[model samples]
Target: MRFISEQRFDNGCLEREFTLGDIPGILWTPSSSPSPLILLGHPGGMNTMYPRLASRARRCAQNGIAAATIELPGRGERPRSAGAERARADLRRALAAGEPVDEIVDRLVIPLVDRAVPEWRSALDALLSLPDVRGPVGYSGGLIALGIRLAVIEPRIAAAGLFAGSFVPRCMFHEARRITIPLHVLLQWDDEANDRQSALDLFDAFGSREKTLHANMGGHMGVPEFAGDDAARFFARHLT
Candidate 1:
């Protein structure tokens, strides 16, 4: 990792921006010592500087946990893939036409998951190599399909804070059954982009006995601030 710039917050947290190969990322750590790391995944279209991501990272830092986020494939400085564009166009059309959710899942969600999971794993490897980071890593944020795949395949993640506002691919239900880490899934009940039943189905499919659901009655953008607090607490408990 090559350092780009850094700033120190009044709360004694240091936020450093860096580049890993072609990917842009940021790491927030307590100024005093190394802490457990949380790999934050941003919602699609948002990069490492997204308000929620930065806010959550600062929150984790305040709680003595390190937080890091890397740009996803086709995002930030990474070159966009033609396949990703095609899949996104298909998803937009399907959602606009009120097409069946399953078709959208098959056409877009699965392809995105296949492209993103490997990138996430690679980013995790780079983040863990940093001197100020420690084990007992946790994952937070969404693009729920990516979370599902990571939870199922990445044994390094001890817990996850998954946002369920995105489409849940049909194949992911089986993968969800394989996730055994502690999970805290947040859902917006009235989200227009998500199939409510599908979200419930995905959450129900998680095999982790320690999973908890925090559902609120609002639109996709209405996730309350308290939900973030709860997620920070969840990560602190598990990752710490």
Candidate 2:
């Protein structure tokens, strides 16, 4: 896996191409006048540049939101067979640590996510520093986003969108109430990676005065069902 190339877009934003563990994805700045900064995450074994997150970023940019997706250290341009093996080992450790096999992806992946936050924050700073840029931070996938919400103790986040994500860092659940910013969650009705109960638990935890939960009748990998106008609406409410 490698970063194939980069392209500059309409607003002096750069679009870069990357090869994930298998697939290809683009990291770009939408041509919107004033864009929001979004940090996209992929499901376990999936690429951050996956369409699930890319399409969402594209939509946000089209709707005047500036977005960017950072590839995870081992899964994107720096993929390795050993990386997959390491992920499996982490999963086992998470289970032994009392985290359910199902939740291992959310719990054990924390260290990887912790390592990725600085990269994400740097990317966020670059995107937000652009003129007229002032969008909230949002995330997809499960572990990475929750990790950002947990590990990074910054107050600049205006809003967050967690799609098919979980609630970890047991200590941070109460902080959800303090976020004050609007939060929107998209939970697939038939998810295999993260269960519905987990989503409900997260919803119950976020209890934001302004929160929206959208349900899609699809599996964990099924992303389009949760895309389109609703995503724009979520970013609009939070970013715009």
Candidate 3:
């Protein structure tokens, strides 16, 4: 990891930005001591610097936990391609039309996950190499597909807090069955962009004996502040 810049907040939290090869990322560490790390995954169209992600990192730091996030494929400073743009457009159209998106998801979302999951693993390796980060790692946020894949494959992640307000491809259901880590899933009861049944199905598909679903009645962005607090407590219990 190559250090790019850093800023220290008045609360004694240190935030640093870096690049792992070509991937841009940020790490937040509390002032007192080394803490367990959480790998935050941003919502679609957002980067590591998205306010929610940054706020979550700060919240984790306040709770004596370190956090890190990397920009997903086709995001941040990564090079964009015409094929990616077209795939995104097709996904949007498919979602808006309420059509079967299996083909589009297979073509687009799977490839994105294929590239992203390994990068997340690589980022985990680099983040943990830092002096102030410890083991018993956790993962939080979305895109849900990437979260599902990571939960299935990344043994380093002891727990996961996933947002279930995105489109779920059929294959992801199978992947969810393989996720045996402790899971805390958040779902919006009336999320405009997501199929409620699909989200419920995905949550039910998780094979973790310790999985919990926190469903709230609101739109896609209606996850309240307390929801984050609850997730933090969950991570504290598992990661710490």
Each model's lDDT: 0.82, 0.59, 0.85
Task: Encode model 1's per-residue lDDT on 1-240: one tens digit a residue.
Answer: 888999998898898888878777888888756678888877565553477777888888888989888777776667888876777788778778887657646776676678778877887887788788876788887777788888889999999999998777787799999999999999998988777888888889999999999998778888888887888889878877
Report the C-alpha lDDT of model 3 over 193-220, residue by residue, as the tens digit: 8888988888899999999999888688
Residue 234, model 3: Cα distance from true site in angstroms = 0.6
Which 10-residue window in model 1 sums to the lowest lDDT?
A: 41-50
Residue 156 local lDDT, model 1: 93
Residue 140, candidate 1: Cα error in Å is: 0.4
Clashing residue pairs in candidate 2 (N, C-alpha, C atoms within 3 angstroms): 35-66, 36-66, 36-135
Model 2 TM-score, 2 decimals: 0.71
How displaced is residue 41 in candidate 2, in Å? 2.4
Ranking by lDDT: 3, 1, 2
Error of 3 at 214 (Å): 0.5
Segments in model 3 whose C-alpha atoms lie over 4 Å from true places = 44-49
Residue-wise lDDT of candidate 2 within 36-124, one digit each (tens)?
Answer: 66666554433533555555666666666665555555664455556445656877676567666644454445556565666666665
Q: Candidate 2 at 123: error in angstroms?
A: 1.7
